[model samples]
Target: MKKNYFILLFILIITSQACGVSVKYSFTGTNLDPRVKSVQIDYFPNNAVLVEPSLSQTFTTNFRDLFLTQANLDLVDSGGDLQFEGEITGYKINPMTATAEQTAAQNRLTITVNVRFYNNIVEDDNFERNFSHYYDYDADTQLIGSALDDAFEEIIERISQDIFNASVAKW
Candidate 1:
């Protein structure tokens, strides 16, 4: 009976402290300030020399979706506590490995974006930098049809995750 009383008392103390803590915790491993309740993401235009027409829309949509799915913040059009704006700056394809016949064995597609993050609640969290990710495909297959679509999806997912981690995950 004495041991049960101690365990109950310990749980009560922990629960009370949690309710009073200022730091916010999410199941997604994000530590967001309670004061920051909303975010705004501007359209990210694809400005790469090798442009893919659909890239701009796809990337921008995915970027916004990630934050909404991962965090508890509401999405806003402008003047949010957290704001993100950027442009897709680079998209390049290059040969990776060489085959025995001196032909391309793998091709790497790299996508880079310049991201600017603003935290109105915490000025120190604001930053502007580039985030990039790549996907490699077998040289025998052309980067069209399903292959190209798959690559774009993978690259976009990685880059968005990186941006999220840098801006809010505090990793």
Candidate 2:
């Protein structure tokens, strides 16, 4: 009887502790305040010196998709509880490494976006900054076809995630 009584007490204590924990946990690791309900993201035009025709559209779509998939917040057209506005500011190709012949061995493709985030509920949380990401490929290979596509995909994914973390995730 004493053993059963102790087990019951232990279970009760654990349940009570769980109830006292107020944080609402989700798979995306966002601890969004309860008052925030909606988000807005403006079209991010590519203003880079070297513009990829589809980059703006692809990035804008991906940026919006991240919030939609990861957070429970509704996407609003304007004046949302949280907002994101940005433009691609830089795109460059640079040689990263040299080969035995003193020529380029690897080249890096980099993209940068200037982001402005607004959090109406918490004014102090808003920020404007640049986020950049890059991918490196063999110098001999031209950045075209599948290679170029893959580089864009990788860089865009990273930049979008960084933006999401900064504006919403607070990471």
Candidate 3:
């Protein structure tokens, strides 16, 4: 019985291979089309009322890096199979938790990015959407230096992942 089971499994594997049955998976959860060979990431400008000096550059580079590391696609200046362009629409800080003394115990910083994606290989995959995320910090910690950097990193990471999912991930 044991030998029969092994033989049956072997036969199944061989039959599947012969029939060209296969599955592809990506660790990054991207299900990009095979025709997508390259990506073009346009500059992400900060158009928010409260702009961070390094936000534009940081976001653009990080967004491109995600494609660079995860996708087997070239980064092109133009005429890419996939394209992305967007602007920072909102950057606002609001008080979160208030202390007993009527002071802000915590504050939240939220950043919103408006994204437009183009898929040359599949026009139906194109989309435009807004991605937003927030980071909370102690009210005593000013939004400068490392505090600001941490906030940027957290928010950017979430937005980048959301954009990635929207563009290529089917789930």
lDDT of each: 0.94, 0.89, 0.90
Extract clashing residue pairs from model 3: none
Candidate ordering by lDDT (highest first):
1, 3, 2
Model 3, span 1-171: residue lDDT tens: 999999999999887774432323477777876667899999999999998889999999999998898877899999999999999999999999999999999999999999999999888889999999999999999899998999999999999988988888854
Which of the numbered candidates is closest to the native, going by highest lDDT?
Answer: 1
2 versus 3: better TM-score goes to: 3
Q: Which candidate's TM-score is highest? A: 1
Tens-digit lDDT track for model 1 on 2-34?
999999999998877755657788899788889
TM-score of each: 0.89, 0.84, 0.87
- Per-residue CA lDDT of model 2 for 44-96, tens digit only, reads 99999999998899899888888899988899999899999989999999999
lDDT of 3: 0.90
Query: How many steric clashes does model 2 contain?
Result: 0
Could you tell me which 10 consecutive residues in candidate 2 have the lowest summed lDDT? 17-26
Lowest-scoring 10 consecutive residues by lDDT in candidate 3?
17-26
| Collision pairs in model 1 | none
Q: Which has the higher lDDT value, candidate number 1 or candidate number 3? A: 1
Clashing pairs counted in every model? 0, 0, 0
Using lDDT as the yardstick, the better of models 2 and 3 is 3
